[model samples]
Target chain A: MVVRVSTAPFDPGAETNAFLAAGRGAGAAVTFTGVVRSSPDDPIIALTLECYPELAINQLASSIDQATSRFGLLAATVIHRYGRLTPGEPIVHVMTLAPHREAAFKGAEFLMDYLKTDAPFWKQETGPDGTHWVEAKAEDDAAKARWE
Target chain B: MKILYFAWLRERLNRGEEEVSPPSDVATVADLIDWLASRDEAFALATQKRSLIKAAVDEKLVAHTAPVAGARVVALFPPMTGG
Candidate 1:
């Protein structure tokens, strides 16, 4: 029902509370958070996300609409962060509420899967050596496509 | 036309976006790449690997031969690495 995208740091608890409150009649809420890992194989000192402002938000909204119908969820929320972020920072978060745990879980997973591969954001990793571009993985596309 | 660059493609080109009027002959995405490559050595180097670059016409992914006549936004980038 709600999609919040911003560059500022996020509060997962606040998002969870809002989703739960909005779907009080629902039986379950599932939340997923994606955080940066401290240890990258390469010398990735930090990660910076770049996105085309309008296009990024539009793509996310469209995907959310598709997911809502596929998962039959009562409510859902998606939050994505931009700008420079060090390791261990949360990059994305998704929450879904449904009449049952099964739907909630599936919906949350579906949102993340699509966001991973289909979202319009790009990641750049900076290190002492130099900055390098991250490559998109085929596995993520396949994961998202499974639901289709 | 507005050309936007993202990810490594930006670094490789050493320039984010620039307005260019492709010759009347430039029509397809691949044609644009070839024309862009002729601009300078950097552009040529950046486009050396066509498979590594992904193009979107007016914000939607397009095939290599996709026409770009009225594209408002032409984005060049490597495949997305977002999660």
Candidate 2:
């Protein structure tokens, strides 16, 4: 598993290509990208993400380890970016490779769910009104609980 | 020991990190939070919603009941909204 936490934006296509190239024998691959969203009602200008870098990396690595073991994944990578991001920009990318399609799909979803609840990155949304911190959703915690 | 705050907790406290000795009575994370809250009004406000607060010891997530005695670094923050 590879985990990257940075302020720089990354190309999801390129990341997927690189990951696929390395997993030669893996029969299935799944990839997911999370983007900063803005709605017509809210009209957000940007999203600012703050992170505890050391802890984020450590927690992501541990989550990846659990995903791999549970799903029998051959390879996985998670790249999460912090700092201010404009709407439509990618905020996170997750890719998983496994011997079978079921494992590949489930692994990616598992990692994404864990990231939503456990990763130590906080988001603040900026808009015409001003900036306010995003609240954690109850649905997200429920999502994570399913895996346990 | 070093204490770190992040997100709204950092905003409320107006500082990201601080060093302090909480005496021997602060044996657990819950005890530590109560101790910190007593230091000032800002801390009291920040920790007002204990259920919304999360903690880490030496960068690893732990429960409020977790021991804080030997920890060199402890972080307190709001529930994560990442990914």
Candidate 3:
């Protein structure tokens, strides 16, 4: 398992390929990439992700452990980027490898669900109107509750 | 103990972190919030939104009622919005 909290942009394709290669025996591999979204009503020029780096890494490591044991995953990786990011830039990437497609898919979803609410990162969107902190959605909490 | 703030809390508090030594009566996270709220207007305002605030002790999320007696680090922030 690999968990990285970085401020630098990364190549998702390269990371995916490396994970797939490392889990050569795994028959299924699933990857999820989240990108910054521009607001339709108001034009968001950039997004700033603020986080306590040490705490963020620790939380993500625990998440990987939970996903691995619960889903019986062969391998997993999570890369989350903090700092300013323009719209359309990659914000986070998750990849899961398992012997079966079902496990791989479910594991990826589990990681993403946990990361959405459990991670230490907070997002602020900056646009023409000015900057505003993004509020946590109740839907995200509900989505995570399904796994409990 | 080290007190850390994040997101808008950090911005509103006008600082990110500080070392604090609360009185012995400050035993729980809630108690710490109450004590902190008395420090200044910014803290009072921030703690006023208690329902919207989330906290972590030593990097682990916990309830406001959780014990803070032996905690080395405490973090306060809004709900997470990451993926």
Candidate 4:
């Protein structure tokens, strides 16, 4: 099932449980929660997420579809938050369930990795001194490349 | 012509979306970029790293040589840092 990518915070455990329950044949389930870091080298006081609403949702759904088709995931869900967010707040969450532990683990990682590098979202970080827009990290591209 | 900018490109351009009418000879994205740069100094600097900056005709990423004369929307962004 797909979760609405919204600014509202959600209970991670409940979300995880639901994903696991959906996968009746799956023996392993893994989840990842991406939170706002308290300190970043760029001096982020806060982060504001911007996206093309319809386009963002469609792209995310398409990514999930690709993962499911390629990996045979029993179930998965992705929740991403947008707009102004404070440090330590949840930015994104993903859960993957599969029959094997490896697929479960790998699938979760893949989802997050693609979401980082390919997803259509714009992030602007505001700091104590000034506000600077975020850029796609070389590290993120490298991370995504490993799975490809 | 709908032009969109993302990431640092947006910041440097100091604008997000704009409607533009390029010269009749602007047949490709490369030509359009040259025209845009000629309009302002910032465009020249920001577009200097043409290899690093990516372009998408409509929603699909395309190469610098891609035709843009008929494109309805054009997007420019730096290599993504979205994680």
Clashing pairs in 2: none
RMSD of each: 2.4, 0.7, 1.2, 2.8
Please give, for residues A45-120, the per-residue lDDT of candidate 4 as tens digits: 7888875444456667877887888788888888888888878888888888878888888888888888886766
Docking quality band of candidate 4, CAPRI definitions: acceptable
Could you tell me every candidate's TM-score relative to the true structure? 0.87, 0.98, 0.96, 0.83
Question: Which ten contiguous residues of candidate 4 chain B have the minimum total lDDT?
Answer: B74-83
DockQ comparisons of all candidates to the true complex: 0.60, 0.94, 0.84, 0.42
Q: What's the TM-score of chain B for every model shown?
A: 0.92, 0.97, 0.96, 0.93
Candidate 3, clashing residue pairs? none
In CAPRI terms, model 3 is classed as high
Estimate, for each residue in B1-83, the C-alpha lDDT of model 1 and write its tens digit: 88888776787777889998888788898998899888878888977989877788887767789998878888887766776
* Candidate 3 accuracy as TM-score: 0.96
lDDT values of the candidates? 0.81, 0.96, 0.93, 0.79
Cα lDDT tens digits for candidate 2, A31-93: 999999888987989999999999999999999999999999999999999999999999999
Clashing pairs in 1: none
Worst 10 residues of 3 chain B by lDDT: B40-49
| TM-score-superior candidate, 2 or 4 | 2
Highest lDDT scorer: 2
CA displacement after TM-score superposition, residue B44 of candidate 4 (Å):
2.0
Which regions of candidate 3 are displaced past 4 Å? A39-42
Name the top TM-score candidate. Answer: 2
Model 3 chain A: worst 10 consecutive residues (lDDT sum):
A35-44
lDDT of 4 by residue, B30-60 (tens): 8999999999899899989787677778777
